[model samples]
Target chain A: MIPLLKRVAVILAAASFAGALVVAMLDLPAPTVHLPAAVEANMAASGVAHPVTAVLLNFRGYDTLLEVGVLLLALLGVLAVTGVRAAPRAVAPAEPAKRMLARLLAPLMMLVAVYLLWAGAIQPGGAFQAGAVLAAAAVLLHLTGILPGWGAPGPRLRVSLAAGFLIFLAVAGALLARGALLAYPPAQAGMLILLIEAGLMVSLGLILAGLFLLLSRDSGDEA
Target chain B: MSASLAFDLLLAAALLWSAWRALATPDIFRAVVLFIVFGLLLTLAWARLAAPDIALAEAAIGAGLTGALLLDAVGALGSRKDGAP
Candidate 1:
């Protein structure tokens, strides 16, 4: 009886959800924008505006910066933990089928990463998106032995690791000194986005690559 | 009701199902991988729900970094189990 009651309850819940979904689909509104007068005026004033990118690198710039910092610090921690002391794991060779696919996709992956970074300055894509793609590519390359680990991160790796943070902080500081913490260079908003976005792409990619180094290799296991 | 709202509901349901399965799975490793899948689904949900910034962070920190950490922890756990007499 208890089991039967539970089954009934589940059926009832599923039925109710389906009913609501049907109602929602029927009532779906067409796409429309009706901004208030003040916002409309503001948009007009900002003739050359990329609102999404602006929001990403200026309004919520701090959050974005910190997010990158988290990745950077994570890599640093991993490097310290496993750089020299920890014995490196020998990555298993990729299957022949996968190797061919990876090689075929490599150039395309590189192109997409570059495109995403370049587009971020003027359009929808940005550093984080591009960096993630680039990192995936790096992981693939590492896995295929196209770029083998040379034991311990060298001096170049150390400096490259912090490049994004150093660039972001210094530029933001200069901006703050002049006017606001990430304010455009007196309406050079596009350029500011470009600079930061470019720097972020490099930083994000390196940081992700560092995480790969930390974990050593892609091992199939659960936490 | 709107297109975005409909999309959100769909994504939410998917995310919930993944999370539920992740918790129920007997294999700890499978559970962790499911959790990462849950994160990915949630990131897509965020995008549909009009929070691309949140989605970006979710994919990077939540799915990417967190997944890597879980894999690392799994290795540590495996080694420890093996080390035990």
Candidate 2:
């Protein structure tokens, strides 16, 4: 009798969720919202043709900066909890096909990542997307034993991991000294955004790859 | 309904089905796999809503990275339970 009651409760919960979903689907307004003119004007001033990039890097720059810090914080939490060190080097998989795929795909992914970063100024790509792609490439390399395990990240890796957050903070600090916080000189806005984005892309890639490696069950044990 | 609407309906149904299975499955690994499928379906739904940027993020970070993390966690838990060397 209790089992039957439990099943009925589950069914009731599912039905409630389904009903809510239908209501939400029916109530959603048509996706024809207009972009505010002020946003367009600001986008022009921000110097990136891609509105999303401009907004993320300029209008809401602080949010993005804080987000990178949040990513770092997550890694720190994982480290404290797991206490698993990283291996100094990676072992290549025995399968020739896996190695071949890594060799062929790594360069291609790197190219695509860079392209995404560059195109973000004019298209749907941006620092976050480019960083994720770069991380994917790094994961591919690590998986196939092209790169060392993150268990023993060197000085270079440490610098790279902090590059994005540091660069962002520096920019914000410089702007604050000049006049307003995060307000770049109109003429140099484009260059500054690009510079920050480049640093962010590298750091984001490293941080993400580091997180994955750190969380893997045998990172330190394999070495 | 038009063909596109039919497609959208099918996609939404698929999303619900996969989500339900993921929640109800007895096997943890199967649930994770189904969750990944649900994330993929969400990516499609984002694209259908004309949010390509969000769709890209959902596909890469949401489905790809999260799925990888979850699978690793499952493996770790299984190993601990089995006392594998």
Candidate 3:
């Protein structure tokens, strides 16, 4: 038999939570300004027409820079906890259909990722979005056995993993000669933003893909 | 009053139900699958909220990557032969 008291408690808790959410949603006042005046005024100066990218990479560049550091730190932590080596697994034969799909879809996914990165200057796409797409493609490749190994990432992978952070720092440092940290010259802003994003996309993709690879390295070995 | 609103409400309900089931289900595999579905529902909710950027993020990072991770983790846990229904 169902526990009546427990059922009632769950119902009450759910109702209260839902009611509070609805009340909050209904009562929350809309912001008076859509985009802050500062953001609106200097949006064009940010190089990219997209406000979000501008804010992420320029207005609040320090935050993005630190966030990349945080991601790398997390990976470091994971590596520390997992140790230097993963137990080798028996190679499983790849299904032909999956192999064909991976070949067909990998290019398509890469193309989409490039498009997203390029579009970020004008549209909703940006470094994070493009990076995620590229990572997804990499994950697909790993899954379909196209990558050919479950071994620890090589030196090239390691360098590219840190590429985004390094490039961002270099850009910020270069701009110091002109003015404040990360402040690009007006004419060079667009080029700088694009350059930074391209590096960020590659690094973010590699980092995320490496994370998944680490997880799958010792598959079926633990509970 | 509009059909889209009705659809959104239905989607919200489904999201809530899926989330509850994902947490409460006894089967680990089923729970992981439900969690993935819940993530997709969240992607839809983000779209309905007029946040395409967030929707893309939810679809890619939240749903796709996290779901893949969870499923892989579950697979690594190994199956208990006697635990099967």
Candidate 4:
């Protein structure tokens, strides 16, 4: 059943590609520009002690803003595909052990999410990771039948989902009025970044959770 | 020759092998599981490269959240197939 010629062709192509990559790596040239040094030089003004955080939330806030928007759009796309009219259905109860474990772990995961959000200002954690952990908690709850798959998100839920992007946009608008986009005043940089991160953490959590929750309703209906 | 270098080489090999298996596996569930393993290995690689932020994100979002989503998709697909004629 095998196609020997095609397989041989594939092997040859792969070997050549690998050989090229190895040669390229071996003969790499030194960098012309040192971005890390530039980032380090400006770290004091970037508002966050953590260089990565500063780059993500301050130096390149526009990208993060767009990323948040993209995520929200993705959730909206999921909602559109799933159709907003599907009614929330009750899921059968999971095993008692799973239920209890979900109850125990959900709160702990929330605490970790918050800790990651807080630590992002000075360490290797941020809104994206924090929001992911929060979403995981919600997923765990749903899997255990503690939380039902979401139907059409209510007005309140919708607002929560958009809150992060809205907040980021508002900040950018205000900063633009003052001078430039997301250019936090040196004195207020820390507070502004924190505020943005807080908003993002909440909205990202909701949006990420919504992706799973919305699509999952179909399985519940089919079941 | 050093211990850390050896560990890094082993990790790299494991990453490549898992990635290959994830792609080549016939079983959808096994492939997804292998993909998750690949993600975790990638997180280790990120950590070894001194990027803990990336490692944490990879572990949580890449491995944890994506794995859950894929597993859910597989379950949904399997159930749909069973219900169909």
Fnat by candidate, in order: 0.17, 0.31, 0.66, 0.54
Instruction: Give the Å error, residue A16, model 1.
Output: 23
Instruction: Give the CA lDDT, 0 to 100, for residue B22 in model 4.
Output: 99
> How far is A1's C-alpha from truth in model 3 (Å)?
16
Clashing pairs in 1: A222-B29
Where does the lowest 10-residue lDDT sum fall in candidate 2 chain B?
Answer: B76-85
User: How does model 4 score by TM-score?
Assistant: 0.93
How does residue A47 of candidate 4 score in lDDT? 83
Q: Report the number of backbone clashes for model 3.
A: 0
Question: Backbone clashes in each candidate structure, one number apiece?
Answer: 1, 1, 0, 0
What is the clash count of model 4? 0
Model 4 misplacement above 4 A: A1-4, A7-11, A221-223, B80-85
Residue range A145-213, candidate 4, lDDT tens digits: 889888778889989999999999999999999999999998899999999999999999999888888
Model 3 Cα lDDT, one tens digit per residue, A1-223: 5799999998999899989999999999988876768798998788989888889888999999999999999878777776667444533646999889989999999899899999999888888888898889978887887764345667888899999999999999888876899988878899999999999999988788777777776674564
C-alpha DockQ of every model: 0.19, 0.41, 0.60, 0.65
| Candidate 2, A157-180: lDDT as tens digits | 788888999999999999999998
Which predicted model would earn the best TM-score?
Answer: 4
* Model 2 error, position B73 (Å): 2.0
TM-score to native of every candidate shown: 0.72, 0.85, 0.87, 0.93
After the best TM-score superposition of candidate 3, give how far the Cα of residue B58 lies from its true spot, in angstroms: 1.8
